[model samples]
Target chain A: MFFVKNIRIGFRRHPLFENLSFAELKPGTMATIIGPNGAGKSTLLRTIAGLHPMLSAAGSANKSGKAHPEQPPIITLGEIAIENLSLQQRVKHIGFVPQVLPQASSLSPYEVIFSSIKSVQPDLNREEADQRIEPVFRKLEMDSLAFEPMHTLSGGQRQIVSVAQILVRRPQLLLLDEPTSALDLRWQLKVFEALQDQVKSTGAVCLMVMHDLNLALRVSDYLIALSAGHLLAEGAPVEVITPAIIRQIYGVIGRIETCSQGRPWVIADETV
Target chain B: MLNPPAKQIAGTSTLTNRHQQVVARRVLCVTSLVVAMLFIFLLDLATGASNISFSQVLSGLLNSSELTTPEAVIIWELRLPYSVTALLVGLALGLAGAEMQTALNNPLASPFTLGLSSAATLGASLALAFNWNDIALTTHLIVPLFAFAFAAGATALILFLARVFDARTGTIILFGISLTFGFNAMVALVQYLSDADTVQQIVFWGMGSLARTSWEKIAIIFMVLVICVPASIIQVWRQTMLRCGEEHAKAAGVDVDRLRRTLMLRVSLLSAIAICFVGEIGFIGLVGPHIGRLLVGEDHRFYLPASALSGAVLMLLASLASKTLVAGAILPVGMVTALVGVPLFVLLIFTYARRQP
Candidate 1:
C-alpha cells in the first residue's frame, strides 16, 4: 500500500496546492486523476515522481489523520518514505512515463529497453539484458520492432515500446502522465490492458493522469477528480462521475449511466 | 484485461546473427576510416618542400637504416611531424565536437561554431601581451593554460545562459557568436596596442600553419589525446544516454546536468590544447562528427572513433591542400578548412532536409 498525504507542490514563490491528501492506494489496482486544463494533474504526478520540489509539512498537521487536513504532505511506500530514498533506490521502485513522447532516438527498441536496467545494473551483459527484455516485448506483441530503430517506428509503436520499457523494469509504483497521448484507439486499448496485466502479475500500483474521461471510467478502479487545484471528489468511478461533479470540474452538462460492468460511463451533453 | 497476445515468434538464430551483423558493420565502418586516415597520412608525407618520390618515401618510412640521406632528413624532420600534428589536431577537434554536440544536445555545437576557438585565440593573446610565461611554469604550458581557462570560461558562461534561457539552440549559438565577436575584437585591440614585433608574432601565430610542428609538439598533443580520449570512452554510457535527451536520461538514473558539465569542460580542454599550437583550424570539429553520424549513426561506441578518424582524414587532406594550393607559398590551413567545410556543411543540410520529408 502507498499513501500520499499533505503534499504541497508549486514553482518558486507560488504554491499550487497545499493540504493535499489522498487515501491509501493498494497494489494490484489503478487510480486515474482527471481534471480540466489548469487543474495541476501533471504537477501532482511529477511531484510524486520527485521531479518537482515539495514543501515541508506545516507545524499544526497531525500524523495519523486520514482526512484531508491533519497529515503532513508525505508519500510513504510501504515502510519507506519516498523522499528519503536515493535516486537509484527510488528508480528501482518507481517507473515514470512523462507526458511528452521523446523525439525519435537513434537507439533501437532493444537498446532503449536495455538502458533502464543497464544504467543501474552495470554487471548485466548483452545476452542477459536480452533475456530480460524479450518476454516483455513478447507480452506486448512488439517483437517485430525489437531490432528496428526507435526513430523508424510509428507513434503508436513507440508508445507501446515505452510501456514495455516501464514493464520490463518491474517497479513497484508506475506513475504515468498522459501515457497514451499519441496512440490510436486500438493501441490505447492495448496499452491500458498491458498496464492492467502488469499490475496484476507484479502486484504493482498504477497512478495515471488522463484527459479522456471515458477511458478513465473504463479502466480505472478508483478516480480522483480535481477542479481549480482542489480535490472535488475521490471514490469509485460511479461515485466520482456524477453529473454534478462533471459540470463542476469540466464545465460540461453531462450524463452518466451504469455500463454492463456496473461502472459509470459518462458523455458530455452540452457546455453549461 | 485484454488477452496477453501471442507468446513468441522470433528465432534465436536470427536474433544472434542480426546482432553479430550490426557489430561487424560498425567494425567495418571504423576500420575503413582508419585505412583512409593511413592512406592520407602516407599521401601527406609524399608532397612537401623537397619532392620525395613514392619509392623514396617508402624506403625512408620502412627502412630507417638510411638515416643520413636527404630524403630521410626531409621526411623524418619536416613532413612527418607536420602531418602528425595535422592528424592529432583533427582527431582532437573531431572528438571534442562530437562530445559537445552530445552534451549540449545541439547539432550546431562545435569548437568553431560556439566561439571556443576564438576564445582560445583571445587567451593566447593575453598570454603573449603580458608575457605570462614569466610567472607561469613554461612558455609551452602558459599558452595552453590561458587558452583552456578562457575556453572553459566561455563554455561556463554559455551553459549558465542556456539554463536561464531554457537552452534554445539558436539562442545559445547567438550567445556564442557574441562571445566570438567580443573575443575577436579584444584580440584585435591587443594587436593594436602592442609593438610591431609582438603584433607580427601574434599575426603569424593566428595564421594557423604547421611550420611550428616538431616531434615535441606532436608528443604533447598525443599525451593530451591519451588523457582526453580514454576519459571520454570511460563515460560511454553517459554519452549514449545524453543523446536520448537530458530529462529522459536523468529519469533513467544518469545525472544529465553533471554529465553535460563535465563533457563541456573536457571538450573545451581538447579544443584549447589543439589551437594553442597550430592556431585555429575551423570546420573539422563541426563536420567530422556530422560525417561520422551519417556513416555510423549516433551510437557513441562507433560514433566516437569514426568521428576522430574522420577528423584526422579531413585535417590531413587540408594540410595537403594547403601545400598544393600555391606553387611555393603554403596557404593558411584555416582558409583551406573553411573552403572544404562550407560546401560539406551545405551538402549535409541538403541531406538532412531531404531525409526529413
Candidate 2:
C-alpha cells in the first residue's frame, strides 16, 4: 500500500504542480496516470519517486503550502534520483522503468536483469540472481533474447527486457513510465497480461504513466487523469473514463462507449 | 521436463545464461590481452641500444646477472628503471584518462584534455623558477615531489572550476584549456624570472623524458601506482554503472557525486605522480583507454586493466622506437607517443563519430 498526499512539485521558474494531493494506494491495483506532454505528469511521477530534484514553492502566501499530508509511504522513481540509489537498495523494493529505455553497453540481457536484482541483493551470487530472474524472463517471453546483446534487440524486445529487469527484483512498488509504448499488438497484450499476473501474484502496487487511453482502460483497475499538472479525475476505470473528463483533462472531444462486455473505452474524435 | 524443445533452446532462461557466458568470455579475453601487452612491454624495454639479449635482460631482472660490466649497468641501472617508470606513468595516464572520460561522460577527456599535464608542468616550472630545490633533498626526490604537488593543486583547481562552472563536460574541457594556458603563462613567467641555465633545464624537462629515471624514483612511482591502481580496480563495477549514465547509476543507488570525487582525486593523484617524475609524457592516457574500449567494449571492469596494459605497451614501444628512430640520439619518448597517438586517435575519432546515432 502507498499514499501520495498533497505532493506539490514544480521546476525552477516554472510551475508544474501546485497543492496537488492524492491518497491511499491499495495492493494488487494498477493506477494509470494519463496526461499531455509538458503537463508535468512525468514531473509529478518523478517528484513522487524522489528522482527529480525537490522543488519548493516560490514565496507562497499559504502556510500549508509545502506540507505533505500523512499517508502510506509510496516508492517514487524519478529519472534523476533513480541514478543516485545503490543498485542493491533499488532492487530490494523499487522497480522503475524509465521513459527512454537505457542502452546496456555490452551487457547481456541476463547481466542487465541480474544487475537490477543485484542492487537489492548484493549477496546473491550470480547463480542465485539467475534463478530469481529466470521466471521474470519467462513471464515476458524473453527467453530467446536472454543471451543477445541488449543493443541487438528491437525496440519492443528491449522494452520487454527492461520490464523484466524491473519485475525480476519483485519490487513492492512498480513504477513504469510508458513501458509498453514500443510494443506491438500481440506484444502489448502479452505485456499487460504479464503485469496482471505480477499484480495478482505479488500484490505489488503499480503506477504507470500511459499514453494509450484504450490500453489503460484494458489494463488499469484505477484511473488518475491529469491536466496541466493538476488532478482531473481519480476513480475506478468505469467511473472515470467519461467523455467530459477526457475533454477537461486532455482538451479533446471524446466519446466513451461500453461494449457488450461492460468494458468502457474512450475514442477521441480527430475531426471534432 | 516436457518443455517445448524450441522453448528450451530459445527461452529467456537460456538467453540469460548465454549473456552470462559472453561476459565471462569477454573478461577472459581482456585478461589474456593484458598478459600479451605485458610481454610486449618487456620486449620494448629489452630491445634498446647496446642490446642486452632477452636472456641476459631476464637474468639481470631476476638478479642472476653474470655480465657484470657496462652492458649490465646499462640494462639494470639505466634502461630498466627508466622503462619501468615509463610503464608506470603510462599506466597511470591510461587509468586517469579512462576515469576522466567515465566521470565526465566525455570521450575527449584525457590527462592533457583536463590540463593535468600543464598543471604539473607549471608546478615543476614554479619549483624550477623559485628553486624549490633550495629546500634540499636529492634532485631526484625534491623535484618530483614539487611537480606532483603542483599538478595535484592544478587538478584540484580544475575540478573546482568544473563544479563552479556547472559541471558540463564541454565546459570543463574549455576551462581546462584556459587553465592550461594560464599555467603555461605562469611557466613562462617562471622561465623569464629564472637565469639561463635554469630556464634551459625547465624547458628540456617540459619536452618530457623518462631518461632521468632511477631505481629510487621508480620505487616512489611504484608506491604511488600501487596505491591508486587497485583502488581504481576495486571500484570498476561501480564505474560500469556510470557508463549507463549518471541518472541510471544514481537510481541504482550509487552516490554519483561521491563516485566522481573518489575517481577524480584518485586519477589526479596517479596522474600527478606519473608526470611529476616523467615530465609530461604525451598522449598515452588519451589513446590508451580508447584502444582498450575498442578491445573490451566499454565495460570498465575489463576496460580499466586493459587500458593500463595497453598504455604500458604503448610507452614501451615508444621507448624502443625512440632508440631505433635515430642512430645515436634517442628521440624523446614523449615525441614518439605523440607521433604514434595522433594518427591512432584520428582513426578512433573518425570511426567513433561515424558509428554514433
Candidate 3:
C-alpha cells in the first residue's frame, strides 16, 4: 500500500498544500490524480517521489507565527517510511517518470534503457541486462524503434522510451507525471493497457497525474480530484467525477455520460 | 497456451541478431580507429627534419642499439619525447572533453570551457612579462609552474563557487565562461605591459609547441592519464545515464551534482597538465568527441575510448604537419591542429548527415 499523511508541500512562506493527506491505495490498484492547472498535482506527485520537499510541522508556521500541533508528514510504501529510506533504497522500490521528455541525442533507445539498468545494477552482465530489457521493448511494441537514435524518434516515441526505461526497473510504486501527455489516442490506450497489465502481473501500485478526465475515467480504478490545493472529491470514478465536482474543480458545466462499456465519460459544455 | 506465436518468436530472433550486429559494428569501428592512431604515431615519429625513413624509424624503435650515434641521439632524445608528449596530451584532452560535454549537457562544451586554458595563458603571460626566468632558483620551470598553479586555482574557485551556491549545470557553465573572459582580459593586459621580446615569446607559447618536451614531463602526463582514464571508464554507465538527462539520472539514484563536480575536477586536472606543458593546443578536445560520437554513438564504453584514440590520432597528425609544413622550420603544433582537424571534422559531419535519415 502507498499513502501520504498530512503532507504540506510547497514554498515555506506560502504552502501550496497544507495538512493534505491521501487515502491508502492498495497494491495492484491503478489510481489517477485529476485537477485543473495550478492545483498542485505535479508538486504532490513529486513530493511522494522524494523529488520535492515537504514542509515539516515545525517549519510550517501560520501567518500569526504559531506552529501547528500536527506531526511531521508521513509517507509510506508497504510498511517502510519512504523518507527514512536512503536514495538507493527508495529508487529500488519507487520509480518516477517526470513530465519532460528525454533530450535528443545520438544514443539509441536500446542504449538508454540498457544504461539505465546498468546504472543501478552494475553487477548485471550484458546478457542478463538484455534478458530484462528485451521483454519490455517487445511488450511496448517498440522493438523496431529501439535501435534508432533518440533525436529521430517522435515525441510520443521518446515518451514511450522514457516509460520503458522506468518499467524495466519493475518498481513497487510507479509515480508518473503526465506519461501520456504527448502520445496519440492509440498510443495512449496502448500505454494505459500496458500499465494495467503491469499492475496486475507484478502487484505494483501506479499513481499518475492526468489532465484528461475522460481517459482517467475510462482507465482509473480510483480517482482523486484536486482544485486550488484542496481535495474536491475522492472515490470510485463514477462517484467522484460528477457534474458538481466538475464545476468545483474546473469551473465548467460538465456532464458525465455512460459509455458503451458502461464507464463514465466526461464532456464539458461551457465555463461556469 | 503451451507455445508462443511463430511471428513473435521470429521477431525476437531478428531483434537479437540486429542487436548483435550493432555491437559488432561498434567494436569494429573502435578497432579501426586504434589501427589508424598507431599508423599516425609511426608517421609522426618518422616526419621530423632529419629525413628518417619509415623503415629506419621502425628499426630504431625495435632495436636502438643497432642505430648510428646521431640517429640514436635524434630518435631517443628529440622525436620520441615530442611524439609521446603529443600522444598523451591528445589522450588527456579527448577524455576530458567527452566528460565535460556530458557533465554540462552541452555538446559545444570542451575542456577549455571551464577557463583552464585561458588561466594558463594568463599565467604564462605574467611569467613572460615579469621576467620570472631571471629568478635563479626556479629558472627553467617558472613558466610551466606558474601556468599550472593558475589553472588549478581557477578550477578550485569554480568548484568552491559551485558548492557554496549549490549551483546546477547552467550556473556552473556561466561561472566558467565568466572566468574565461576574466582570464583572457588579464592576459591581454599583461601582453600590453610587456616588452616586444617578452610579448613575442608569450605569443609563441600561446600558439603551442611540443618541441620543448622532456621525458620527465611525458611521464607526469602519462601517469595522470593512467589514473584518470580508468576512473572515467568505471563511470561509463553513470555517464551514459547522464546523457539521457539529469532528472533521469537522479531518478536512477545517481548523485548528479556529485558526479558533475567529480568530473569537473578530473577534466580540470587533465587539461591543466596538458596546457601547462603544450601552451594551448586547440581543436582536439572540441572535435575529438564529436568525431567519436559519429563513429560510435554515445555508449561511453565505446565513446570514451574512441574519443581518446581520435584525439591522439589528431594530435599525431598535427605534430607531423608541424614538422613538415614549412620544410625545415617547424611551425607550432597548435597552428597545425585546426588546419588538420577542421577539414576532417567537416567531412565527418557531412558523412553523419548523409547516413542519418
Q: What does chain B score (TM) in every candidate? A: 0.84, 0.87, 0.94
Clashing pairs in 3: none
- Lowest summed lDDT window (length 10), candidate 1 chain A: A58-67
Per-model TM-score on C-alpha atoms? 0.86, 0.85, 0.94
Q: Residue A64 of model 2: what lDDT?
A: 36
Model 3 chain B weakest lDDT span, ten residues long: B1-10
Quick one: ranking by TM-score, best first?
3, 1, 2
> What tens-digit string does per-residue lDDT give for candidate 1 at B160-217?
8988877665677788899899999999999999888778767766767787667887
Once fitted onto the true fold, the runs of candidate 1 whose alpha carbons sit more than 4 angstroms away are: A58-73, A139-154, A259-263, B1-17, B53-63, B69-72, B125-146, B159-171, B191-204, B341-357
Candidate 3 residues lying further than 4 Å off, grouped into runs, are A60-70, B1-12, B133-140
What would the per-residue lDDT of candidate 2 be over residues A210-255, giving only the tens digit for each residue? Answer: 9889999889988888887678888887787788887777678999
Number of the predicted model whose TM-score against the real structure is largest: 3
Q: Please write out the lDDT profile of model 3 over residues B1-357, one tens digit for every residue.
A: 112133366645655566777899899999999899888888888888887798998988999987899999999999988899999999999989989999999988898888889999998888778775465433247788889999999999999999999998888889999999999999889988888988898899899899758888899899999899889987888899888888878777777878898899999999999989889988899999998998899999999999988999999999988988898888999989999999989999998787655
Q: In lDDT terms, how accurate is model 3? A: 0.86
- Models sorted by lDDT, best on top: 3, 1, 2
Put down candidate 1 lDDT per residue, A1-272, tens digits, no spaces: 88887687766455667668888888887999999997788888777776666665543234434444545457888777996666656777788777766558767676667766677566788777777777787677776666666777887787777677778878889988888998989878988998999998888899999988899988999999988757889989778888999899878999997778886678788998
Clashing pairs in model 1, backbone N/Cα/C closer than 3 A: A5-A73, A6-A73, A7-A73
lDDT of 3 at A135: 82
